[model samples]
Target chain A: MIKKMKIWQLPLMVICLVGFQLYSDVVLAHGERAQQAGIRMRTMYWWDVDVQPTTVKVGDIVTITGKFMPSSFWPEHLASSEVASFMNIGVPGPAFLRMHSYVNGTPMVRSTRFFRGKEYHFKVILKARQTGVPCASCCQC
Target chain B: MGYTDSVKDSDNQSHEDTSRSDVSQDSAISTPEQQRRIFRAFDWMLVPVASILLGGIVVFLVALTVGDWDYWQDWRDRRWWPLVTPVSLMVAPAVFTYFFWKYFRLPIAATSIMMGYMIAAWVSRYANFHLFADFPMAFVSPSNFIGMAIILDSVILLTRSFYLQGFIGAFLFGVVIYPLNWPAAAAFHTPLVWDGYIVTAADLMGFMYIRTAMPEYVRIIEESTLRTFGEAVTPLTAFFAGFLTILNYYLWVWIGSKLAVSRWATKLI
Candidate 1:
């Protein structure tokens, strides 16, 4: 009877392991959601964000255009954008190479000061270097 | 009956004494060869393990001190990278050089430790940066140090004095770092115009690859007025690094000497 029970246990364990593996969520990109809710809500607000030609082949160029407004009610604890800020893209590793970036038609190769409550239009040209579903988001540093 | 028992006991005692003597004779003859074999086995086991442990400690020290300077190619600037990396890296080799040379009379400590560090570092760069983070191998590859390590060991071997080793070997170790790594880094340093702004390929790559939490402003590259010198920046940084490396080498060697003192506890409670 003991021998029969042990034989059944092996199959049960294998089924459990396979089920877990199948249902588990895989992480392929950065966790922006891990940021504090207050920070996410109070910081810069993005709109008119668009990525053209959704599909891109290796060496193909993709253009991302967007507009963002710095919130008037910025968190007091956070550093003010007036001191120093840089417009950038948040992507996983080097999935795409940024060919060019512009803010209000001005080239953004270095940090620039941003006034609170000011709306800024931006454009970014990216060259695809690797094949992946890149999650690109505008970031202020 | 008593007489018979005594006679049997005497025979047993004689047999036991003869067996004991034979065993003693065998051990006495084989002791030196057995000891030699045991020591050989210990050397085979201990050397690699010790090297790996030392290598791990050195990597940890480097990670803490040098931090991002050695991690990313873009961080390998003419100023801080050239200055910081060699000085930080010299710690392990300098410390172990004193320990190994004084005790074992072996000048190969730096070479062996560096070999171990390179193996471990390459494995880590591949496993953590390339495979896990999906970064390109070229982007996250570690700098080569075997050539520098060999020179350090050779210095100690040639000049059996630590003072001379520090003056010559340590200075060379620091000065050569930039030149040694230049071939790999020169392509990245080539000037390119991106959107009417002059930037290096490394700068472009740094801007493109988004390190989630690391901000652009935090990067400490060559941003000073020293850029006016242009081509002279790297050599100036290397010479300064060499001077600092000599100081660091002597400091670590002194610490190593103190640690190498042969003191033992008489009893454990």
Candidate 2:
């Protein structure tokens, strides 16, 4: 009876593995998710994020537009945007090349300050260079 | 009892004295050939070990001082990168140069240390940045310093004067970095039009590689006023760097001399 059960265990494990591969969804997370919840919630509030033409062939341009407001309740422990801050896109690898990025129509080629409780609109144009399902998100540095 | 006993005592003392002298002679004696072989073995062991330790120190010093500038292609801008990299890099070479020249009269210290640094830097760039972090080799490649090192060493060899090395070699060390590295960097500086915006290839590469550190936070210090210098900004930056390097070189050489002080101990207490 012990020998019979051992022979069946391998097949059962194989079936479970195959079932998981077939049924499981691919869950992905951005680097920002690793930050503390308090910091993520209190630092900046992003809204109205829109990525146009989500699917594109190689060399096709994709536009990402968004607005964010520095939270009035921004944690005092964290650095203020006035010190050193930059708006950038978070993407997977070199899948897309950023052609232009602007904040309120001002070219953001260098680090700029963001005032607390002030709303800022941003636009980024990216040219796809590789084939991938890339989730584009805004990031601050 | 008196005469024969006295003669025997004298013989014993003489024999003891001769044996002591022979023991001392055996301990002190070594042929020139044997001495050379011993030194050769020491050199074989010491050279690699010292190179690695000094090279590691230089790499750490550079990383702590101006790491960001040297790490990425996009950060290698017109103003700060050219000025900061050479100045920061001069520390180890300056220290080692003084040490080697004062002790051995060998002018190859700068070249040897620089060579070790290059090896260590390349290995780190490959292992840490490229392979581990998944950054491209082109984006993370280190700048070439061997050429500048050769020039510095040559100046020391030719002039054999610390003042000349400070004035000529140190200046050349700073001024030559940009020009020496220009060939590798020029391609990355090529202009390209994307979405009606002018961007360099380096900038484009920086954008393509998504780093945790954003592009906007890059500490490139090319100012608008300096941009007016147009094609001459690089040369202007290089000259200023050379001046700073001269001052820095002398300071480090002084420090090196103090560190290289040797004293013999006559008394254990």
Candidate 3:
């Protein structure tokens, strides 16, 4: 018997599948790739986020320096700063050993109070581990 | 009859005949045995392909989008942790239901869905770690997903009712994840010292594990001091999580049913 579906429909399905894979977004990183411009304008703006040696060898010590200024009109939906806030950075895991982190040129170990409209410069020194080193770091506050 | 009327009548008949022939040429009704063989072949081809496709897309999107890795302590510390955390994760179970209700049906649907979902999650997480970022497998692991699947499936199997499964099964499904993961969570709850912050083991693990490049706002969760429930005394979060799961179960089941009634099923004949 003649198979009409196999003749035309099957080829279309295959082409569609192949096309989907080919055009699929190739994300070089994880998390939302782009942040809404309004969100950035309304919320915290960190203009200078500088990390030296974009690429580092295993066990090589690296430093992260950035200026963070929180948005004055903070959205009510977000977490309230009434609770304990910390000066933290986002990292992959223990893979990149954090030797130390300093905020406002002071040695900091724990969660600290973050002030809105304050341009506080923070620095973190991390050693790249053999297996993995979090190439990214973000504030948990 | 007049000459013009007879000619028009013949033209109309010929047109109807041509249309009927076209329909017959497109597809033919098969014998019962042939239909059975066709269905079996379709099953063999569609099952693996569909599961892999759906599972891969859903799991990867969840992981890439809302996945909280390198910091379970901070994650669990949130107030709406239970309600919001499972929002995206619910996609897998929701879609997996289609295969269960449509083909596998009752009694066996739970087990089939569980295995299929597990394989799908395993493949996606493994690929994410190796191909995209060199994060640890434990970060995006789906081991906990197994319990939820069984609970969702068993609700129907044990109760033999859809509404009951929605209310009870989904509740059990959400509540089960915490206890099942308690042993893992317990390890993190252990008191420890890290950078003199007086943190837990889980916090230390976060300080230790390295995610290549993650953002700050992404780690946002409701971390209220009131959320701390006297060392799991009330299981408030778990219950809340279960409540949310019930909502998710209904939503997912509805979606599954809609997908089950596809245009393809009409073509089977």
lDDT of 2 by residue, B1-269 (tens): 33345455545654688865465457532334454566678888988778777778889989888886788888787777789988998998899899899878888888888888888999999999987666889999999989988988999999999999999999999998888888898888887654455668787677557665444334323421112112767799899999999999999999998777763223332
Q: Between 2 and 3, whose lDDT is larger?
A: 2
In candidate 3 the C-alpha lDDT for residue A46 amounts to 77
True contacts kept of 3: 0.37
Best by TM-score: 1
- For each candidate, the alpha-carbon lDDT, in order, equals 0.77, 0.77, 0.59
lDDT of 3 at B41: 84
Candidate 2 similarity to native, TM-score: 0.70
Question: Deviation in angstroms for B91 in model 3?
Answer: 4.7
Q: Lowest lDDT 10-mer window, candidate 3 chain B? A: B221-230
Cα deviation in Å at residue B139, candidate 3?
4.0
Q: What is the interface RMSD of candidate 3, in Å?
A: 5.8
lDDT of 3 at A69: 78
Query: How does the DockQ of candidate 2 come out?
Result: 0.11
Question: Which is the better candidate, 1 or 3, if ranked by lDDT?
Answer: 1
The sequence of per-residue lDDT tens digits that candidate 3 reaches over residues B119-232 is: 876766678654466556554455456677677777777776778887887787767666676665665566765555565564554555544433233233323122222255
User: What's the residue-level lDDT of A77 in candidate 1?
Assistant: 58
| Docking band of candidate 3 | incorrect
How displaced is residue A74 in candidate 2, in Å?
7.6
Interface RMSD of each: 5.5, 6.2, 5.8
